[model samples]
Structure formats: structure tokens, C-alpha cells
Target: MKLFDFNKYFPDEKACRKAFKEMRDREGVVCQHCGSHDVVWLESKQQYQCKHCRHRTTLRSGTVMHGSKLPFMYWFIAMHLLTATKKSISAAELQRQLGHKRYQRLVTKQEHP
Candidate 1:
């Protein structure tokens, strides 16, 4: 998608989170601990609770953005930049484009080199 189109679809962090949640819901949320399909979404907590194991799964769990504290918009924009271009993007360049101050936030040590 073009930059304009991406901006149109994801205007803010809330939109990105909503889109991510929808995608996750479509893929189905299974309990990682008990292997159960019976999961409930706790909107207030922004997590999924397994009916059998009573385990709580974060929305970012089992996804690429797992364990990340950055805003959802950051991930969406980074993904858009990576796929919307033909050439490969470096970690530093991606950080620059995202206007993020920290280089480590965008890539791991193994990925940076």
C-alpha cells in the first residue's frame, strides 16, 4: 500500500491496535498453556483469558510485535515501510523513517549487523 493509503487506514495508534486485534481474532486465539480454544477477550484488560487454564494471553503474544512496548502505530508503519518498498531496509534506516530515537527498539543484535 502507498503511504497515503496506509495513513488513511491507520490514522493513529488506536486504529492499529483495533486492526491487529481483528486480525488476531480472525486467526483464532488458543491457550498457549492448556491448548484450549475456549478463550475470552477482556476488553478492559486488553488480553485473552483461557477458560480452562485461566491463563492470560496478551494481544501481541504469538505475533511479531510480541514483548514490544512501542505504540501499535510504530509496528504498523514499520511493516508498511518494509513491504511497500522493493528494496530491503536497514535497521538504522527504518528507525530513522519511524522517527524513533532508539536503534535497538527496531531490531535485535543479530538482525542489525
Candidate 2:
């Protein structure tokens, strides 16, 4: 998606989280610990609790952005940039576009994960 469309769709962290939850629900949330399909949404905790195992799964648990310190908006923008063009974007260029002083950490987390 284009930057404008991405921004329009995912305007903030809350929006991103809601969208992620909806997508996960649509696909069915399986418990990583017990491999059970029976899960409940814990709205207060913003996590999915496995009915069989009581294991909790966060929104980013299995996503590329899992464990990343950056905000969802940053990840969203990075995804847009990465897919927007035919040629791949350098981490440095991405950092510049992101206007973040420290790009190494973000790039490393995304690359390794």
C-alpha cells in the first residue's frame, strides 16, 4: 500500500492493534503453547488467553515486529517503503525516511527476526 493509504488505515497504535486482532481472529488464533484453537480475547490485557492451557499470546507474538521496541507505526511505514518499490531499500535509506537517529537497532531486529 502507498504511504497515504497505509497512514489512513493504520493511523495510530490502537488502530494497528485492532486491525491485527481482527486479522488474527479471522484466521483463527491458535495457542502457541498448547496448539489449541480455543482462545479468548482478554481486552484489558490486550492478549489472547488459551482456554486449554491458559497461555497468553500478545498481538505481536508471531509477527515480524515481535519484540521490537519501535512503535507499530514505524513498522507499518517500513513495510510500505519496502514493498512500495521494485528495488529493495537500504537500511540507511529507510532510516533516513523514518527520520530516526538510530537505525541499526531497528534494522537488526527486523532482519534477524
Query: Which of the numbered candidates is closest to the native, going by highest TM-score?
Result: 1
Clashing residue pairs in all predictions, respectively, total 0, 0
lDDT of 2 by residue, 1-113 (tens): 67788889999988876877787899898898989999999999989999998999987777776777777777777877889978989989988998999866675344533
lDDT of each: 0.87, 0.82
User: Model 2: which ten-residue window has the lowest total lDDT?
Assistant: 104-113
lDDT of 1 by residue, 1-113 (tens): 89999999999999999999999999999998999989999999999999998999998887777667778898999989999989999888898898889897765333311
By lDDT, who's the top model here?
1
Off by over 4 Å in 2: 108-113
Cα shift from native, residue 109, model 1 (Å): 9.5
Checking candidate 2 for backbone clashes, the offending pairs are none
Off by over 4 Å in 1: 108-113
State candidate 2's TM-score. Answer: 0.82
Q: After superposition, how far is residue 56 of candidate 2 from its true place, in Å?
A: 0.8
RMSD, model 2, all Cα superposed? 2.7
> How high a TM-score does candidate 1 get?
0.87
